[model samples]
Target: MPTPHRPSAPPAGRVDAIVLGTSAGGVEALTHLLPTLPHDFRPALLIVVHLPRHLPSLLVEVFSVRCRLPVHEAADKQPIQPGTVYFAPPNHHLLVDRDARGPSLALSADAPVHFSRPAIDVLFESAAAGYGKRLGGVILTGANADGALGLQAVKRRGGVTLVQEPSTARAPTMPQAALAAGEVDFVLPLEQMPAVLRAWGDGGAI
Candidate 1:
């Protein structure tokens, strides 16, 4: 794996899960980012992308073709598994919650935040509550400010926070908002993010 030239000291805890949020240019961005993660990458990945609630998402199919890791549309109560990538199903908010059996996925039809049912904020905030210091939150290319507060929540809970550098993003609004909100741990280009994530997946000592 490539060495991560992080902006700050990497989080000391093992990252149990990674939550990523993106909109506008998400497909293009993820197309580059997901393929770089090895098949054996250990942290579970959860993602949210803004889409029309009435339409079916082809994200799982499209990403599975490029990503080495297994990809699935997140299901309610599904157990979180290492090396798997879960995408929020259209119209539902995807959340992570710890139960007697460990961390599991939850789907909510609750009101949308920032006009999105599968809001990035909901997922990141829920994951922050569930994983605390063990979670890693990524805010990538998007046209909205949905993820800013959520990234802050992750940082407040002591989780690592990564924001795509606005200069390199197809849509800088989301990352810019996150940076403006403060407490972001890393501001990196798309290429570097996978390596940083891989290092964290490999137990964080790169």
Candidate 2:
């Protein structure tokens, strides 16, 4: 796992990409957050929600209706398109490969980091490395510590980092872990996060 680095405020700006790792009580937070943005919002969304290793994830189907943009499972080596939401399904580890051209998803067999094949650190580190300062990471409600190290990576790379307030979270363990790690950029309740994310998504809040 990458070292923890947190900032009270991330430099004011819009991120080109947004990566979210969530579990436990994610549906409520995500449903609250996604529907607030316009259908054409530009930033790409990469999301991972830890699921039972053998079950098929229906998250994409469920979120697509709540989200304005098209939601789909990520395809390995497929180029990421703007204004779309991509999800990690079942047990595969989803990652991004960054080169001079840009970032694209890579499905990997690397052993689980933090005991999660779809580890939050894996996505955050790869995304931070791929998008650099233009990335954003959000770690929502979860029962475990999977995302703590990953959210730190996003902050270290100058990307925005946010945590759904533990008090507001249906499950507080993940948010509390993130808060203890460092002062995140936003410790807002789920209801208020969409505003910040929307403004950020559209190339800086106006």
Q: Which candidate comes out best when scored by TM-score? A: 1
In model 1, what are the clashing residue pairs, if there are any? Answer: none
Task: Report the lDDT tens digits of candidate 2 across residue range 1-206.
Answer: 96553554343446888999888888777888887878878889999888788887888888888878999899899888888898976688888887676788889877877677788878888898888779889989988888888888888887888898898888999889988887588888888887778767765443
Residue 161's C-alpha lDDT in candidate 2? Answer: 87
The residue pairs that clash in candidate 2, if any, are none
Candidate 2 lowest-lDDT run of ten: 4-13
TM-score of each: 0.93, 0.90
Window of ten residues with lowest summed lDDT in model 1 = 5-14
Candidate 2 Cα outliers beyond 4 Å, as residue runs: 1-13
